[model samples]
Target: MPNVPRKPRKQVAALPVMVDPKGQVRVLLITSRETQRFIIPKGWPMKGRKDHHAAAIEAQQEAGIIGRVHKQPVGGCNYWKRRSDHFDYCRVKVFMLEFRYQLPDWRERGQRRGAWLPVDDAADLVDDPGLIDIIRTLPKRLATKHKRLALKPATMS
Candidate 1:
């Protein structure tokens, strides 16, 4: 090979969330293994899974949370992933997971910590600017989803 440039790795992330009884939305975040920097549940592509499904798997493994992952991705972000020999830039596609339940134990439970915070706080905690931008737009996207859901009953009848 003459001088081919390296392509950024593609990854998927789960934007796990729950809505309180009062209608406030909270987002779930986890710490990265090495640096312990706040981040969403994310990982590399799986051989037999679609991007969103893979994201759900990552959430389950990393955060011990299970949910329905929205088929359409909410947004995406890019971050530099540190590797042994060199660093790699990775592009992440974030899928929203509407949490159903949390497990008591999970694969990465001992290796990482997870937290649920308001979107603003979650945005503040994460170091990635691209991820922060995605977090900022989530509330509007969620509101639109809820409004559509609220109107569904009327249209059904």
Candidate 2:
């Protein structure tokens, strides 16, 4: 018998961001259930939803956030999902979700903690280099998109 390699599992994530009253960009991050480490909300793709929509759903479930998700993915990152016996390699596509409103209470409320942090602080909290890069480049990417769309700017309140 010969061994064969498995492909990386596909996943989706939502990068939830907002500009505060001071016009400072901030990102929302949730603590992982097991490790308690800061991470963006992500999960396996839903059967009936688009990738970006699924990412939005993940954000709602994991972080209790609802927002407008960009149709296009900004970037992707590969990570190792820990399992009981071994680790599974996963590639996650990241979508930017414009913050709308937060629920007073929602599912998974007590299981995890969510926080809004400055982009640089949020990037520094995450462990993955690829994810870090995405967070670090977010402000510029967002500004470019707003410019391309002919919007006033990304200094949304």
Candidate 3:
């Protein structure tokens, strides 16, 4: 008898925090048809594509935003859920990327709309505090990086 191979685990990436020029920290939240709950924009990674490419595509399709992904990965998380008919816990890695543009015509996407809110307000909007924690940390991290760069000595020509 031949043995059947198990299906691969599912992985998803989410962008939990974004920043504006004003230095305000915000999160891009999406409401899906299957789930009424507001979740950070995310989707399964596409094969043969870079992580950031998947992230960018997910943002455009799910949130109707066209943007560039940051090079750094803020952090990742793991979670579990049932797969097919079998009950299983799957590990999903979360990523944080800032949406580089505003959605002037988000209605065109026809999937869902998104909004940017203060990190604190965003925390209140989402059900999971863990996600909120991720959003809240972004501002401090970006600010610290900016400060360090500003303090660096100027390079000689």
Report the C-alpha lDDT of model 1 over 1-157, residue by residue, as the tens digit: 1222377689999998777555667788888999999999999989989999999999989988878899888888887788877767888999998887878788888898777787899999999888999888788987877622111110000
RMSD of 3: 9.1
Query: How many backbone clashes can be found in candidate 1?
Result: 0
Indicate the worst ten consecutive residues by lDDT in candidate 2.
Answer: 148-157
What C-alpha root-mean-square deviation, in Å, does candidate 1 show against the real structure? 7.1
What lDDT would candidate 2 get against the real structure? Answer: 0.83
Model 2 lDDT tens row, 46-109? 9989999999999888877878899999899988887777777889999989887776767778
Model with the higher TM-score, candidate 2 or 3: 2
C-alpha lDDT of all candidate models, in order:
0.81, 0.83, 0.58
- Write the candidate numbers in order of decreasing lDDT: 2, 1, 3
| TM-score versus the correct structure, for each prediction | 0.87, 0.88, 0.69
Candidate 3, residues 1-157, lDDT tens digits: the string is 1222354355556573554556556676776545556666666779998766776667666666655565445665444443456544434445665555545544435555456667777778776545667766767877877622111111101
Scored against the true structure, residue 103 in model 2 reaches a CA lDDT of 67
Q: Indicate which candidate wins on TM-score.
A: 2
